[model samples]
Target chain A: MASTRSGTARRQYGVAALFTAPFFLLFGVFTLAPIGYGGWLSLHREQTDGLGLGGEPQQVFVGLDNFAQALTNTRFLGGFLTVGVYCAVYIPVMVAVAMVLALLLDSAYARAKRFFQLALYLPNIVPGLIAAMIWLYLYTPGLSPVVDLLDSVGVPFSLGSDAGAVGAVANLAIWEHTGYNVIIFFAALQAIPREVIEAATVDGAGGVRVAWSVKAPMIRGAVVIAVLFTVIGAMQLFTEPFILMDAATTINDSWTPSMYIYTLTRSYNLGGAAAASLILTVVLAAASFVVTRFSRKGATP
Target chain B: MSDVSTLTRPAAEAAPPAVTAPERRDRRGVPPLLSKGIVNGILLAATLWTVLPLTWLVISATKNYADLYQTGGFELARIRLWDNLVHLFTFGDGLYLEWLRNSLLYAGVGAAVSALISVMAGYAFDKFRFPGKERWFGLVLVGVLVPSAVTTVPLYLMASDLGMTNSFWGVFLPGLASPFGVYLGRVFSAAYVPDELLEATRVDGAGELRSFAQVAFPLLRPAFATLFLFGFTGGWNSFFLPLLMLSDHHLYPVSLGIFTWKESLAADSEIFYPLVMTGALVAIVPLVIAFFSLQRYWKAGLTAGAVK
Candidate 1:
């Protein structure tokens, strides 16, 4: 028994070893190490006296202060609130629009699906900076064709105020991401067994009946996946707001935990930065786990 | 092919073919006009929404601030493109070009090498046997869930400890290790590689590397293309690490460079708005080209890295 076990072990070891290397080494150095080290760094704060300069800042262990501070910080609070509101508005619109597009691509009248798929999905591939630039140009005074069209029609419009910033940013995200989700949903829609649809048609069901009764159930997992990724991403929402900083002026520095960390790091508060990062790490991990648990459940059933 | 249309096309597409065919015969057989009209209208609107802002990027990249402010965006006018290119390539000691180069290098080399490493590792993991295999596989899965953003500060500290901070390597070296690649390699090997082939090669006395190179590697081209494209995109799009690691403008990647440009503009100065716009547009070209040409690989790539 032992010998057989040893032989099987050796075989598995040799085969698996080769397959895991490139990823393992990279994952270890670039990924796992940083996470472990970040945890360690978060346990201590650099003690600084008046001016926080002219004297050496000593790293001293002060358990939980940094985490507590980060948690209670008003800006962090506001940032979280802002992003939560943003996600509330962003996720449903993006996902619903994507599903609708995916359904359209799946429909009969649409020609050149490859063209539409590529076109719809193209915005996703555009770098965030470029996407921001394009949107920012449209949002800026006199540079906006929409504003011009609005002026030509004499309709009052503005994308500058607090009420408008989230919507404007959300609009960019919708443009960038809807196509991506649409493809996923479209693929799911594609993966639906044709026999099922044919059966529905034979049963005298119209397209709406087929979609609501049969198609929707089958694509639920994909919808969940789209939602999961969007949610995970929505939780981290940084680049959009970061680039739109000009418009988000009333947005304040700690518009999100990420921004908060950026601010702390910029202020040269390494300890605080480390602590805030650690807190974010924990929150994100917890959130990701919950998403994964539900998504896996969704994927399987 | 027939199934393709029925499965993937949007719902209002539901009406078009039926409508046209029924029209040829009679109006009695057509589905409701509202469903078709609503679906097409909404879909076209959505597609337009997706396309418009990005369209502005190309047009904005070509125009000067004068045209931009005057018209507020996009002219078919063939002006300022050369001037924008020249300025973007030469501005402030030509740092924008350096960032672009850094991004290309990071994406090109980092992804290529990482793909090779993942293929080898994945192939081995699937085909060969070693100790602690399950443990290692589990570790990789955990690593997959771990976002790189969480590791930025720790990584920066580690780099500073190694005296690698502010160097191009500081930005690029870490990119070479991708947990996702290894897992993907594993998935590809499992799905595509036949154990019998490996056994046959062994029977013929091909060594491990020889079997992988001559037999297994050929089977992995699709997977490699997928891995390379994904790895390249991720590397190119990465920003936080560069922000944390490099202070000197010369060492920046396009993502970090744009952020810095944003910050500079925020410093209440006249700012390099046009140059930044031009630079942002230039930064997207490589990704756009990569996606258009490599889209086939992209679908396969997503399955391995993101989906399954």
Candidate 2:
């Protein structure tokens, strides 16, 4: 009996391993190994001999020098500030826009909800790079009707300026994401128990009042998750700034963290780039931890 | 099972059932605190804001180089959209076509295989008990947090060391292991596939692999489709990794190709500018079509990730 049971257990183990082996192999070799390799790369520096002109640069061990340099690098920290300002502008504006649209769609006064939903969710289909490209054209002076319209309205708009760069990038992100989040917020609103809204209605709560007081609060979990995910996603801000750099003269190679890393790679500073990548990963991992924890709490209720 | 049904439900029939109650109340006599005109007006304005850039892209695609420069974005001139597309296709001995083909190959093949790998792992996690299962899953969850951009430099380093840089394999290989997809797959397997079905298949003398292929995988189709669409968009949207790995123009995805074209615009604005505009439109058309046709899957995918 013991031998038979052991045979069954062994068979189950073999089957399970067969099922899971492909994922583990790919994840380990591609994802896990790179992470470990990046850490190792982060601890070394490439050094050249004899005026640095002839031989291949030998990678020499460097003890925390890259991290120290990254810590003190203004361009690196400036990238963080750029992203911070972006998040400051982006998160509230996007959430508010999405929330308002969702509430309006959920309201009794709205018509053609499906049409509106599809219309709004359209931009999410465009790739981020393409979205940035589209916006780049729109930000162009003579080519853009938007620019023409602003010019005609007596508003000076130059995407090349720092403030303009921030606004342009933020607007591009807003245009791309607002409608998608609207769908999310709208779905969360739909999932709210009908009785609660009715109860609020019975208490003489007006439409706006009930939307703000009851509906928004009830879907607060979704709102929180959306915000947190947006924050995490914001850290990967590369395509927009990378594309915008061509048009916006003020935007440079190291204008964002991902851009900073890319610039490092472009200059053949792999160790420094790897260190920056590790720092970014650690920050993102912490944010992700918060997301997972909050998500679990959100799921429970 | 119910989650799958709701996810797969036709959009027309999926309207909020609770909408009628409020509509009835409004008709009975409660004055809306926000005016009807105001609410709809806000929505209309929001819709316009969302639709305008796409509309601009379409209109801009139609203008010639001269008209593109001379005319405003909304100005409709002699329609050169077809001409521009021809130019885009025929440019530099058909470079754009190569980019498009590369994109389709990467996104299409990469997403399909990635989804399958995820589903297999997810099925194992959900249906089987094993030593160190939770620990392995925790590692995957950690992967879900490691942003792909951060890993790109390291991946590029490792790939170059392996002599795989500037090749399709470098970009293609990394995209296949999405930990989030694995996580979603586990959730889907638990929700959609019952262990009793697997047990019955076992009793019927089917092998483990055979049961998974014939019995469980069929039920996991919705999850698979959702995962595929998610992977598809991700692969399609991926730009940085390819930008790092690929140097040969022939291997460039449409996104990177377009960026190269845009970069050249500073030198030859008259030629590359119109091409970039038309190229952006062409590149997005497939994705737009896919999104519309597979709207349900994307919606389901978004909610799954968001809720998780």
Candidate 3:
């Protein structure tokens, strides 16, 4: 009897593992394994001698030296500052436009809400790389009719300038993501109880007033979530910058944290790359935590 | 599940479902309705702003290389969209077609396998009681928050160690493990699968897998749609991982192909601009159709994520 019971237990375990094995196996090797390995890599640096081709890179354990370098590097930090400014301008503009567009769609006069919703959300479905390429074409001098039109009108504009590049990059992101946020916000708005809105209207509340006090409060969770996703995404901006890097000469190797990591890794300095990513990961994670916790606590009941 | 949460709302989170009391109606009141025509006009204007770029893109695609520049931008004068496509497909011995083919393989198979794995794992996690589940799941949640792009180099290093870099499997394998998909599956299981039904199935001689396939999977259609859309979009849009893993131009996806085009275009600015425009227009077609079809799933998915 004991042997039979043990065999049944073993069989159950085997079956369970078999069912979940694919995800667990892949997750372990590709995701979990790298995270652990990245931390280890962060603690060591390579010492290459002479021409660096004839000799192998010697691995020397360097504690906190990478962190030291990252902290002290003003040029590296400029990447952070550049994106920070980008987000400071980008998020508000995008989210505000998204919310307003959603609200307009949510309004009764939007006869074809479904059509408009599809139109707004469609841009987001296009791959960022493709969208960037298309926009790059538009931003091109002779090929860009928008530029040609502006030039024809005597308002010549080049978006590749350092002054305009941040805005240009932000515009690409906005075009790709505003539709996504609009979809989320519109869902939030639609989720608002119609009867409640009707009641607010019956109570003499104007459209703007109802939006500010009633509809807005109800959709606070959606707003917070939209902002959080945007923040995390903006901080880790990659595709547009990668696609547009050549368009702007002023942008450096480390135009963002992820870009910095890419630079370090591509140069075969995996240790420093690992350290930079770790720092970026920790900072972004902390930001997510603070955003969620603070918003949850401060959310209107 | 979709309508229950939205069609009827509990008075409060702590309150049990009671008869509709209709308490505390907003007593303040609304302003008179604006002219309905004016409201529709404003909405129409917004719609134009929303879709004009895409419209211009389509129109510009039809324009030939000569007409593209000769006749100003965003016009109907240069109707060579078909010509532009020919150039795009013929460029560098037909690389664009390869990119399109690669994209389909990555997005289609990766998304299907992903949906299957995510649904099963999510169902198991939700319905089964096991040790170490919560810890493993928490780790997965962390994985979701950290952008996969952030791990590209590490993934590269690890893949290189195994000689998988520069291979198609390198791109396909990592996509199968998605934390967000698992979470969505869990949510779907919670929303769809009921304990009483599971108990009945178990009592009626259905084994666990049998019960799940016959009983739970059908009810998880919304979850499947959500996962499929997410995975498809992800697999389709994925650039950084593929960019890192694969180097051969033959193996390149459209994103990388476009990148190469951009680099060449930078070197020599010429009529390839029309090709790029037409290609961009063509590339976006399937995605736009995907939106129209999958748009409903997004609203439901977002509302679900928001509520919990």
Candidate 4:
């Protein structure tokens, strides 16, 4: 009997291991190992011995010097500022647009809600690189009807300028993200107890007022989730600016922090790139933690 | 019921009910017709914002090279969609077809395997009472928190060290380990697969793996479908990792291929412009169709990922 029990226990472990091996194996090798090696690489730099042109370089320990260098480098610092301006422009406009659309759909008077939802979400199906390329043509001076319309209307629009580059990238980002977030916000809005909304309506609250004071506050969790994910997505801003760099002259290679890290790898500065990657990760994780904490606090009360 | 209530009520009181309608309309401080117009007009504009670029892409694909720059986006003149498609397909000996095939192989195979692996791991975590189970799950949660873009460079460096760069394995293998999918898988497992059914199978003397295959997996089909659709879209949309991993133009995904063509537009706009416009349209069609068709799964997937 004891032998049979042991056999059953061993079989259980075997089956469990068999089921989970692929995920653990891939995650360990690809995700965990890279992170560990990245930490190791972040602390080391290549150095030449005496008159070294032909010999292979040695890996010398640099400690936190790479992080310090990344922090102080103007181009790298400028990348953060560029992303800062982008988030500043992007997050509010995107959340507002998505929230407004979600509210409109939730409104009693809105017709064909599913059609509006599906149409709004159509762009989210387009890949980011493709979306950026589509907008690139639209940002181009002569080929774009939008550009032509703005020109004919006596509005100066130049994709070559820095503001134009930022706006162009923001437009593409908003176009892709707004609808998906509208879905998120709409789901949250739907989860609200209808009685609460009815009660608010009975208290002389109008449609816009209920959307503001009642619905938005009730779905604060979804709003925070949306904001957190948007912030994370903003941190990984690469595709749009990278594609836009071809059309927008003011956009540099190191336009965003991720772009900066990519440029570092392209230049074979693995240590600096790893350090920048870690820095960005730590910052993003910390930001996520704070937002989660804030959301938790808001939830409790 | 309305007719019965009206018959039960006095005629004078019933007649006064119509006056309440205008008062109820005044409660919102705006007439219903005007507000409906305002709400749906804004929605229409927002939909247009989301959709006009796609419309432009569809329209621009039909224009020839000269007409692309000369004509407006919606202008219909000398439609050469077939000519442009021929150029796109036959360009550089059908490079676009190779890209389309590569994208399918990467996204299709990567998403299916990734979803299966995630479900398996999630099932094990839920079913087995292993020591350090929560610790193992925490590691996956950590993976979820750390964004993939942060890990792309280091993965690239390691892949290069393994002499795997510029190959399909370089891009394909890294995408398979989606920690977020695993997290979702766990949530789905708990929601979908009931333990009693597995216990009943155990009582029937079936082996654990066999029981899971026959009983649990079928029950978890919706979860698998959800994960697959999300993974498929994610794999199709991935840009940064593939961009860094593949240098061979033949191995480039459709997105990267379109990007390269557009990047060279300054040097040779005449040949590449219409090809890119047409290529963009072709690349987006399959994913759009898939999204609209299986939207039920994706909508559930989106809210599931966010709500938790």
lDDT per model vs. reference: 0.73, 0.84, 0.75, 0.83
Superposition error at A86 for model 4 (Å): 0.9
Off by over 4 Å in 3: A1-16, A48-54, A141-157, B1-42, B267-271
**Model 2 C-alpha lDDT per residue in residues A1-301, reported as the tens digit of each score:** 2335577668888988998899989999888888888999899998886675677788899989999999899999898889889989998999999999999999988988988999999888789998998899889887787888899999989987899999999999999999889988898788776766776676567788989977876676677767877888897799998888878998999999999999999899999999998887777777767766775575456
lDDT of 3 by residue, B1-308 (tens): 23223322332232222325467554453324563566567666656655666776787778765676676556679466677888889988888899888877788788889988888888877877656777767776776786665567788988887898888888888888887787778888898999899878866767778888899999887888878878888888888888778888888877777766767765655656676777777777766666568767767775565454
Stronger candidate by TM-score (1 vs 4): 4
- Clash pairs for candidate 4: none
lDDT of 3 by residue, A100-160 (tens): 7777777755678877777777677888887777676677787686677879999766765
Query: Every model's DockQ, to 2 decimals?
Result: 0.42, 0.50, 0.44, 0.45
Give the chain B TM-score for each candidate. Answer: 0.84, 0.88, 0.84, 0.87
Which residue window of length 10 is worst by lDDT in model 3 chain A? A1-10
Compared with the true structure, what per-residue lDDT tens digits does model 4 show for residues A1-301? 2337668777878888888889999998998888899999999997778796887877789999999999999998898888889999999999998988999999998999999999998888889988988888888887788998999999878988888889889988999999999998897788676656665676677888988877777666677778888999897899888888877898898989999999999988989999999988887888788878887686555
Regarding TM-score, does 1 or 2 come out ahead? 2
- Report the Cα lDDT for residue B292, model 2: 78
In candidate 3, position A2 carries an lDDT of: 29
At residue B274, candidate 2 shows an lDDT of: 76
Candidate with maximal lDDT: 2
Candidate 4 overall lDDT versus native: 0.83
TM-score of 3: 0.88
lDDT accuracy of residue B58 in candidate 1: 74
